[model samples]
Target: MNLINKKVTHKRFGMGSIVKQNDSIVEINFATDNKKFVYPDVFGEHLELHDASIAHSLHQIIQEKVLEQKEEEMKKEEEIKLQRKYQELRLGHEKLMRNHKLHPESQMVFWCDAEEQNSSLSEWKIFSGEIKSGNNKGKPNKPIRLHQNSAVLLTAVEPGRPEEDRRILGVYMVKDGFIGKLCEDGYIPAHSEYRLQLTEQESDQMLFWNYYVNEKFPQKQTWNTGKYRYFDNSWMAQILRDIVALKNDTREQEQAQQFFDHHCKMNQLIEQDLPKPNGSLMRA
Candidate 1:
């Protein structure tokens, strides 16, 4: 119902809400800087649902900045931590070199297929009473914000669109009072999500890929020239190949990997999802 902090999420908006409802999109404030943003998209799953306490903690981490007087305190703590980590790495590297470890230069590099999402768990599971089987039921009647002076949690997705795939992640009470839900923690098919936090750049890549893939496919029966004109573009083709790889169909891993291999190579996976929006297709 409400978000106490400002967080970057995979939605059109980046901040969280304190009092949220279907029509109360204007009630949100971003923890990033105490600024406010409101829009039509805010009515959707602005954040994922998990636990309320964790969500509150995440909010505190984002909205509550370290005070100027506390800066030196944190700085000193960070300096000690860096010194320990650096020493550990240095000692390990020395041991490897001294022992004639044959590790390849390329082997030292790391590759992570997963992106990050920012999410939390819930304390209070808020929901609306059952609606008539066929009525619109309209939206929630209240501000949709939960009162949690305790722990909280939330869920979120990575920034990726049609062409790209992203995994979600969730965290615990990383900060303090947070409650979360998409449309007040209740939607037709809303699911509890876990999120992985990522940089803005990574988030941009995800959004770009999602748009490219969705516009080209849009969950249709097939991909055809009538629906997507850009599929014929060479750059699009190249990007897919560069970031995705192939695996045997029966030797499956996960949907994300499968998609990466298919379109990331040939854009073969989503061809069927693209169709004429008018619903006049051969299959139909």
Candidate 2:
């Protein structure tokens, strides 16, 4: 915006006409002498344009800049909070690693069939299981294979893209015995722990093939056909480690905090407290 030759008023300088204008500075010709001031900065506080239309336009621009600055500050504060949470969680995870070992008495990896890339990563409140062999075979069933309080690492493969690589989506811990009913929706755990869901960026880095491959045929990925596969403590530990590494390498603090919050809860789990898998029946 050019202000050259425009009349202006300074609170102290009384009256003046803008003699020159530059990107950052504006000069004015006061009755007594010439004066210079910072552009825009002086308009709202130290000076005002004499023309009503131009003055209104400048006022709107100034208001917009102020609003943008406030938003930027708020964003910075939120990022700081996330960083603080991350540091606290990092310390907690270190203590857990030092004092405990992996427990997979019933831990398993679950694969969700999805078409959209982030379908499995959505705010999931229930998960469907498959009936291995029965009249209603391949239909949604309760998670009969999971023991109460066991950890389940969730993965996903887009439907019709079996040949493409899969991605690890999230993790969940089951609640006490079978709490779901025979409904079309799916099963619901009494509680989900370390309920971590990967962001799109995080999922890209956690390809299923990159972590778990067939032992005999190093080139082949495991869990080729099954919806769920039991994974031992070693596999569980590997997944946990990879998750921690991924969180540390990303700048998305809000997403990382969700993982850290639930991850710390995992430290409190005790193997003996978990119920043995007894193939309990779902509610009628």
Candidate 3:
């Protein structure tokens, strides 16, 4: 038997050991480290097994690794699916663009990381370098310090609520992680105003301090941050997401309106000078 490096769990031996090996079946000595038991016929020959102190620990590491692998695989699969979906969506929009009757200014929404790999539109340009996803990292995929307005621009806005609708429509990507919907398309108005919701609790007090510290506010932490109770990351994340949405909505709308005004003025000037169909006397 060639099961020298095979790691195994022993009820009696505890953890550690390598397969000394034998002819009939297989013999595994589990008395390498605090463990003391011999297992046979479990792991086959030609396998390498290591010793573990806690039987569960060895299993735990294996399980964790397995879960990690599974998560990575799932992420890759999702990326593939997302790529396909966006491609299909892009083709659909291209088809729509070909139809003269279809208005091109419809606004829509979609999500993005700092990377443009998953953009819904062809024009999407995501942020690069450490701000996006890093080549190497302290924290995994850490987002860089973001400007309030720029952050809003990076935020995705879809035809419907992202929570309810999986497929957002009509948004286009521009340079530097900037994306917005066209007027004729399903676009969300971008704004950058936010409202804070806090309560008088200990944990809330801590959060207040966290926010203040983050904002460089020298304000003292109140009893709220100390006593505040929150369910978990999800609840608070939702609030943050909402605030970001509101802020972006305000900013984009203002910008969109400005464009409208400029366009309207230019159109009016052109129409005034252009020859009228009648060309007779159709002045107001």
- Per-residue lDDT of 76-99 in model 2, one digit per residue for the tens? 999999999999967765664454
For model 1, the stretches where C-alpha displacement exceeds 4 angstroms are 1-199, 208-255, 259-284
Off by over 4 Å in 2: 1-105, 115-128, 135-142, 158-164, 176-193, 215-218, 248-284
Best by TM-score: 2
The order by descending lDDT is 2, 3, 1
TM-score of each: 0.17, 0.42, 0.26
Mark the regions of model 3 whose C-alpha exceeds 4 Å error after superposition: 1-54, 101-274, 277-284
Report the Cα lDDT for residue 163, model 2: 34
In terms of lDDT, the poorest run of 10 residues in model 2 is 275-284
Alpha-carbon shift of residue 55 in model 2 (angstroms):
98
Computed on alpha carbons, the lDDT of every model, listed in order, comes to 0.32, 0.62, 0.32
TM-score of 3: 0.26
1-284 in candidate 3: lDDT tens per residue? 24455665544454445545554344455555332232332332322344334433534554666699899999999999999999997776565444423112212112443333234233432223222245544322212221111211222223453322121122221222222221222222223222121122211212212211111222332122211111212222222332333333576545433433333242232323322222001111
RMSD of 1: 31.0
Candidate 1: count the clashes: 53
C-alpha lDDT (0 to 100) for residue 264 of candidate 3: 29
Candidate 1: residue 196 lDDT (0-100): 19
